[model samples]
Target: MKQNSLRATVRARLSGLHDAEARVAHVVLDQGAQLVHLSVSDVARLAGTSASTVVRSCRRLGFGGYQELKIAAAREAPPEPRDELDPLTATVRAAQEALGGLPATLSRTDLSSAAEALSGADRVLMAATGLSGAIAVDAAYRLRALGLPVDLPPDPLTAHLAAELLPQRSVCLAISHSGATRTTVETARRARAAGAKVVTITSYASSPLAEESTWVLLGGGQDLVFGMEAVASRLAHLTIVDTLSMILLGLGGGRSERAVSASAEVTADHSY
Candidate 1:
């Protein structure tokens, strides 16, 4: 099997693993067949846990031990000749699976609370860094097109300062795929300290950013592979942004539609 196929197999069983075991599974799955080369201790270190967690994850996956798991993974059939196309195929499949599973992961109450925070806020500050920074900018454009007051500075410090100075009844939408981006997490903390409602969109619900959020929107799926930044996590974050925008627009009713239409009309002047 191709590396992605191996990851798919492990991911399918992740739901059944205990939390620590699940983290181990994710680390293994993300590493794919490469996990076969790493000893249990290495995997434990990479997964931010102990060897016992790796062993438990192996058992949870129905293996006798980490070595057995590695051997089994090594024995799987190699990818077909068309494996060159697998990356694209795998990424699309991952994004679809992730988006399909999102509703079950995030409840209507969670979405509703997020929409309420954005809709009621006098100003909306978007904080993000790296790839997530692009997502924040895109989301801010979409929200501002509907006449919502949005601030999305390209500079991290500027964004952080915006979060710090956010007034009461303001909202800060922090986008961080890892949920561990120090700048984004710190901005979330400062936003809350200034009494602004914080909405966090992240890949994991248990991340530090989620803990700081007044409302948390978990991405639909976990990223199984590295080096593919736009595959699962980016799609998941964009999906959450679009979903929240729709929900906020729905709550705003006809007035919001008119705002969006008017914004489009103004921008149409630059079109060919």
Candidate 2:
């Protein structure tokens, strides 16, 4: 039978149930989420009935027992009138689903190479501009907190200039949503030309920025579809940055101790 028809059957059988069982049935129809999540005891509490009464209610409504009733009700339940999510909640839920699929988009070999280069680099120079520049600033602080020497140039022009002078074996970590940002790309190019390994986080794997880098991390952030990158892309990039930071910390020993020592010492005064 159709799901709606199945639920209708339950309601049709409701009128003949004993009074206590009818009360439990009313609670089931009124609170759909309860049918899916609440236990017999919980439903009993909500309906002001005994747990045994709740089970009998399910049997009268054509279920073998409470668990069967829950499964049948959950599978056949109609959308409740009050079922709605506000904008902020809806966005976070969408982002959560997208982030769960991130591992498939990112390449393991590329990630391993990027981590090794970052761990061994003489220093890391990160280049970005516009909104992505803010991500770079935050990422630099995170890497620095791990005891790594990281630099984020103050502007695109400065980034290009700084990239030009990076020492061999250094890493240039580029942050760009489009991967086509001219100044950011040029900075990565200059870093590569200087023999620094260029590691990139970008939304497109086919972008020019990906072409110049030793390793590229792909993040097809949803915000890119709107022609300008913002919230969704930032979260994707931040997730990647945070994962890398945790990996670096796991290597342990030198600089990781900065968490308890030098870095903490400096920031401790600002907190309270």
Candidate 3:
């Protein structure tokens, strides 16, 4: 089998690994580019672990051995010269880069399939937790304003009940950044089991939530800096939803055009 990118694969599996391996994994994930230049012993020492523990961590990450892990780490290391922008600007730039990265990640076939899914469904349900819940509400609002039947459940339990109540041809869009949100994943899984076609929006394609969905829309991973005001990942997700909404509206032809025009007219009267 072809070798996976160690950094990506291991990071995706971090939540499932044992504590020791997880600790080592977190260190590498948080500082892999810098850790690439260090030896196994050095890494173990820095992680406050042992050499044998490091080796085991590598194996747990699916590498044949420490040497192979090191090679993969080096390959994924950040380029020699880092961007010089401040953290907030850098975060924005990263989000823009991630947006550019989406075309290759999302194919024309995927977009068409998503559009078809939304257009053909009897109703649409959106559910998310935490910050992602806010995103779900935004998407639900836009779809509803476009005259598509949409429901945004206020909580996971309500979302689960709504999923169970969905008609046979309904569609559910589950938004989660990590794709490891237990409640959201379970809700999506149940939605799928109920004959609803599920679409997942997350950062990692290999995540459990992604595996359960019929279609997956991957966004950028979290923005580490920009302090508490950071919205890079959230913005990326909104962009994804915007793309989907536009595609669905386009498929609705003149009906959608007139609906949008009417909505704009209503909003125009309130503009200051």
Ranking by TM-score: 1, 3, 2
The better-scoring model by lDDT among 2 and 3 is 2
Candidate 1, residue 4: Cα displacement in angstroms equals 15
In candidate 2, position 184 carries an lDDT of 93
Consecutive 10-residue window with the lowest summed lDDT within model 3: 1-10
lDDT of 2 by residue, 50-153 (tens): 99999988887767888877776665545433227665665664465335436645677887778878877888999898888888989899888887878888
Question: TM-score of every model?
Answer: 0.71, 0.65, 0.69
Candidate 2 lDDT score at position 15: 40
The models' CA-based lDDT, in order, is 0.76, 0.75, 0.74
Show where candidate 1 strays beyond 4 Å: 1-20, 23-85
Model 2 lDDT, residue 47, Cα: 88
Error of 1 at 68 (Å): 26
Scored by TM-score, the top model is 1
lDDT of 3 by residue, 1-272 (tens): 11224444554456567777788887776665566578888878877889999899888767787787777666553632235777666666556545644553454676678778887888898868988888998988787767678888778888888988889898889898778799899888888889999988776666789888898886553345444222655776788889988898978777677778877888899999
RMSD of each: 7.3, 16.8, 5.6
